[model samples]
Target: MTPEDHGTEALSGWGRTMRRVCEVRRPDFDGSLLDAVLGAPRLTVRGAGKSYGDAALPVNGVGAVLDLTAFDRIVSFDEGNGVVVVEGGAVLKDVIDQTLPIGWKLPVVPGTERITIGGAIASDVHGKNHPGAGSFGHHVLWIALLRSDGAIVQLSAIQDADGFWATIGGMGLTGVILRAAIQLQRVDTGWMIRNRRRTRSLDETIAAMRAGGTRQELDPERHVVAWLDAHTHGASLGRGIVDEYYAASTLDLPGAVAPFPETRSPGSRRRRSLPGPGVVTGATIAAASAARWHLSRSANSQLVTMRSALCPLDRADGWPAAFGRSGLVQYQFAVPPNEVGTIHEVLAYLGTHGLTPALATLKNLGLGTAGPLSFPIPGWTLAVDLPARLLRPGIMHPIDKLVAGAGGRVYLAKDAVTDPELFPLMYPRWPAWRRTRHRLDPAGRWTSGLAERLGLLS
Candidate 1:
């Protein structure tokens, strides 16, 4: 089997902060190529590298990095059963473009369609609609995992419950995910009716999210979230805009199974580029937030396509590059509804340190996922992206103390820094997850920089 071997290249995840020189392996679509890589002394699977942190990155003491983009293929789509079987590396964008026109959409569409099926499963990614849709894994029917010892294992809740949940958010440590059968959502025009409003205070923000969070059925079309202003203080600590979305009215309604008669969706027209780090400072963020609030008056109850509704953030290309050389660290954590005070404290803490998160966001998550390593829980989740310079130890310590004390958990997928000592406290299922990891990979062949930092491989 031939291989596209880009020998010893510098590799990094989307953050572009941590770069490592490593052997890169790209496998072709044919069957034998994957087996060849599995036989390597050590290696880790990487897809799109859309993960904000090191979950998909291979660094020190790691093995060759498998660039799996070439393995992308939509093997089959069974509209009759609403299930699509896809190759592990099949990107969400490709899947959406192909399926949306045919009246189906990903049940759990993440913020960016650039994610790959393997990466989505490894991270157990949740979406704006997670409160009702749960997560990407919740809609996954089955996975074809290639174990370290050259065994192709098929897993499902009933087939291999232990391996199944472990692999869901197991951070690719369980095995190399080869393929998956996932359920798709039915859509008419891939369009939504959105409601936008400006909120003044933390309470107002929470109330708006709660009021807008009413669900229709299995889908969370009522995706409620707050686009917050991190530079604000005092009376307007969490002041921002809350946007809620619902199915478009019946006047132009395409029934769930009806063919999409119009174009799939138009892309965002936001600025495509920005000066790195210093250019996107606290002051800039404040201005941007305020501008959005004012413009929101004109944005209310507008019809938007699925792409516009689900991933407005991706409208701009190379946005993260705006963080410059300092890179970007997105600190995303979840705290129970009762401890929302922690959310306030986290924002207050960031402000106290004179750091303004370029973008701060809030969302209400659903009940905990079945996967032990899954990040979502019944709570309020806040995510903020800060320049790497502001991601100092002092800033994280106070936030960690508040979150852990409140029984809140950090999302491993978006994490760049967290004291390893505190991880077990955040994820009580660590022991069980570790045991399952050992069962699937006794030698711990499947690993990444995150596993090493979290002490999961130890």
Candidate 2:
């Protein structure tokens, strides 16, 4: 079991925060995977590096960062049953390209399709349709996990449920995700019928979500989300646009599942990369926010590709660069149905500090997941992206306490700075998840920067 030395390299997640220098290694397929996991002194598995924080990084700037992109492969697909077997490193976009041609798509996907299947499972990512589709883990039929003891085991909801759920949102602390068999959903086209509604206030935005049903009941067919303008104040505070979508098949002629178009959307050619810090400011954000609101207000119903409807940020590519060198911190928290005030309080806190969030969205999350560490619960969730420079310890800490007190939890995938002391309160199931994670890797061989910071590695 020998490993190759790729030398030391600097690594960070999508947010470009907490950059760490770590020894790096890339193992080839089959026998090489086992050798890589067993031969390394200590390491963390990284896939596409799409997580917003340190979950993919090495702790304390030491250890090997295992690059698994080479393991990407679509092993096979059972079109009859809508199940596809893919390597852990397989990207979601690739899966969609191949499977969609045959009338199948990933049952659940995150905002960015560039993320790897392995990352999705490790994070248990959710989408705009979370209330109906749940998180990525719910769609996984089984995972082939490489444990710390050098054993490969198969896990599923029914078989080895403890190991399975633990690995779902365990932040790669349990073991290496070798691959997985995923259940796909059928789609007739690659497009969605989108409708936009302008909301006057935060209350109206949430009421639109409840319009589908009760505050808790979200219509499965209609994918819903809202874009908020944090710059507005007084009567206009929380003014935003709400978007509702139905699959193209619901209104258009049903046909073979189509692939994402090769041609880019108009104005996408003008997209630019983030050059450095100080590019994003309150003034720039306000202008952009106003432009977005006015543009949506003019359109009521339109035909948009699933890519446009689901992952609009993908078009901007390196848009986060606008946040400058300090990058950005995305604080996404979810609360129960009755605790709606938490949203108002947090937003008002940001407004009072004059730190306008550059980007914000609100959605209704449905069922709580079986994975103990999974973030979503049945209620409303709001995610705000603020420039790292503008956010101080004084601000985030209070928001943390507010969220924890409201019986809510932050999304570990998007979190970079939450006091470890507040973790247990936010995620009460941590003890159970930790126990299962320990049983899978009793030596605590699988750990990351996030695991260590949040005291998940004991």
Top lDDT prediction, candidate number? 2
lDDT of 2 at 60: 73
Q: Provide the TM-score for each candidate, comma-separated.
A: 0.93, 0.94
Q: What is the C-alpha lDDT of each candidate?
A: 0.79, 0.82
lDDT of 1 at 30: 49
Q: What ranges in model 1 sit over 4 Å off? A: 1-6, 30-32, 216-219, 249-278
Error of 2 at 294 (Å): 3.2
Which residue pairs in model 1 clash with each other?
Answer: 276-322, 277-323
Cα lDDT tens digits, model 2, 1-458, are 14874678877778876789888888877687777777776889899888889999998756788889998999999889998999999888888878866667786767778889999999998888888888899899999998887888999988999999999988888888888999898887777778788988888877887664342244444578888888888767788988888777644734443444443433422223255666788788889988877676735558778767777767766666777777888999999989988988888999898778989899888886799998889888899998888776767888999999999999999989888999999988899998898889955567788888888765
Task: Compare the candidates by TM-score and give the number of the best one.
Answer: 2
List residue ranges in candidate 2 displaced over 4 A: 213-221, 250-276
**How many pairs collide in each candidate, listed in order?**
2, 2
